[model samples]
Target: MINKLNKSYWENRYVNNQIGWNIGYASTPLKTYIDQIKDKSLKILIPGAGNSYEAEYLWCHGFKNIYVLDLAHQPLDNFIIRLPNFPKNQLINADFFEYENSFDLIFEQTFFCALNPNLRTQYVDQMHQLLKPKGKLVGLFFNFELTEEGPPFGGSVFEYNSLFKHQFKMNVLEPSINSIKERQGKELFFIFEKKS
Candidate 1:
């Protein structure tokens, strides 16, 4: 049976503490990318931001306009507890596709892979819609086989390229050089600029 990775599904995972995807800290690849961004005022969104270590990292590093969105309330709750000073308004508990707001940058961590594979098209479209013109969608994507057995579903480089080629200008799609040990060679780092 196809696992419909919906809100309830995710909420249950958090309730059960079955989140193997939670790395407990901002991923090295994302941190390295965030470090290079010179625009501190960029409106940034981190969807499916479980534990939101990246959001915490961004806020701590002076990125004031950061937003953290999650389908499940458990993680967002944890984040608020961890970073109480973070703006309560920026902690969004909502479905990503339904959340309407344009941002200069969106950080993709496990969000795409966590969704059901059938939503790939919708994910791309929503991402395109959510980004400002010439804005970027940057992060790591798993470079593994796509199968029915996972919320951490995977896709090949060719598949990702084809799915995003039409709307995003490929700026940097390649093997991530600074992935954490657990994800060493399994992820593809990408920086896709929304096509103008």
Candidate 2:
């Protein structure tokens, strides 16, 4: 049976223009994290990356080895229009779970919360598998209660700690101090390195 939250569900969301999770620009916490990274050549992946402003920022900052993957084509097309010079090959249209690749870093935004709660473990495991040794998975996660009525389902730091600790070294997981004004205090910034 196809998962209820599979491609069709997400595609419909894009088709209907119901992407409230899209912040329309590189979010502050993520931008700050990317700003301090000294290396410009690190391979990076941003899955479930709807109209990925972060990818655009990275590309503009000379991070050419950046990939933005999404199941729907609309956002990818929007990204292409927004950054016509961005390498076409790096705009991936694929399922995050089935996508196969290794990266120096992967960014998490609202992607995790958009997924079904039952898949949290799989999300963590896939993130581990997709990273190179010492690779980092970094971004913001919602800091609140999880509920069925959400694509923006919330989560807590304690839950994140237990989920990621076994496969990743939790380098940072704390309430985001620099989130966009609306998300401030309701999100946690995290950086988790794959456990060798």
TM-score of each: 0.98, 0.96
How does candidate 2 fare on TM-score? 0.96
lDDT of 1 by residue, 1-196 (tens): 3466778888998999999988899999999989898989999999999999999999999999999999999999999999999999999999998999999999999999988888899999999999999999999999999988887889999999999999999999999999989999899999999998
Among all windows of 10 consecutive residues in model 1, the one with the lowest summed lDDT is: 1-10
lDDT of each: 0.93, 0.91
Model 2 C-alpha lDDT versus the unseen true structure: 0.91
What would the TM-score be for candidate 1 when compared with the true structure? 0.98
Give residue 155's error in model 1 in angstroms: 0.2
Instruction: Report how far residue 5 has shifted in candidate 1, in Å.
Output: 1.2
Worst lDDT 10-window in candidate 2: 1-10
Positional deviation of residue 91's Cα in model 2 after best superposition, in angstroms: 1.2
